[model samples]
Target: MTGVSRLDDPMPDSPSQTTPIPPVDGVLTMFYYNDLQAAADWYHRVLGFEKILIAEGLVLFRIHEGSQLALVGKGYGSQQPLAGTNKGAILSIQTRALQQWHERIASHEAEGIGHELHRGGNGRTVEFKVRDPEGYTIEFFEWVE
Candidate 1:
């Protein structure tokens, strides 16, 4: 008989074992705006996000599959006002397509939105910073693989 170690024994599978993780559904972002209507319009027209829900100065948009973006009216205390401005909070949005996202933001800038778009470190991502009508800053980014 050839010498063999118990360590070479075949492992048995268990019912508790699981494989193949599920993909992430989506992401959600919330923004506190003084004017929900303006925020909704900006996101819809400028960012190409479709409005999914709106109620009493609160608006929610479907930014992507299973992802939502929200605009909440002021006085909710979720955000603080910016220094010397009536707006508050900074929002960052991420995407996988940099060029396409940048073009969209650029179009908004061309319309005199007063926002700036720049390339991030290592040129792997492009970011656009825009202030809402209420002075809150929103940063949109597209990550390069």
Candidate 2:
């Protein structure tokens, strides 16, 4: 056989064969909102997110480093609940600076607000939550270990 490798042949020994695949880079959570621009704007104002795109049926925002939140406009497809409710889901974030994150969220003024620091009974993590404009819950956490 010539030096050229065939498709059926095993690869010659090389570092590439043992290299690991890369880990996940980020996450994007989508929320259905009838008033898409308003929902995007409210998140931008309250949580310091910036608009990343205004594509067909969705407005994307960068909510944190490597994390995104999208507001779905009319005609977007989802198994979402009614326009203003999310009863069984939460957007949980892992953060290192819990206190600083709390300070930023607490600056916002809104109805149905929720914000408090909590320590798990066994003292493993610290966390807090703040409700979004449309009432979906977002939790932030940091491990004590």
Question: Against the true structure, whose TM-score is highest?
Answer: 2
Per-residue lDDT of candidate 1, residues 1-145 (tens digit)? 1453233454357332445456878777777766667767887887788888878757888966887877877765466324434443566667666457667767677333334456774575677666666666666677644
For 61-117, candidate 2 gives per-residue lDDT tens digits of: 887778898888756766453655555677787789888878887777644444678
Positional deviation of 107 in candidate 2, in angstroms?
A: 1.1
Clashing pairs in 2: none
Tell me how far the alpha carbon of residue 112 in candidate 1 is from the true structure, in angstroms, after superposition: 9.0
| Model 1 misplacement above 4 A | 1-26, 76-89, 110-117, 121-124
Once model 2 is optimally superposed onto the true structure by TM-score, how far is the C-alpha of residue 144 displaced, in angstroms? 2.0
Q: Rate the local accuracy (lDDT) of all candidates.
A: 0.66, 0.74
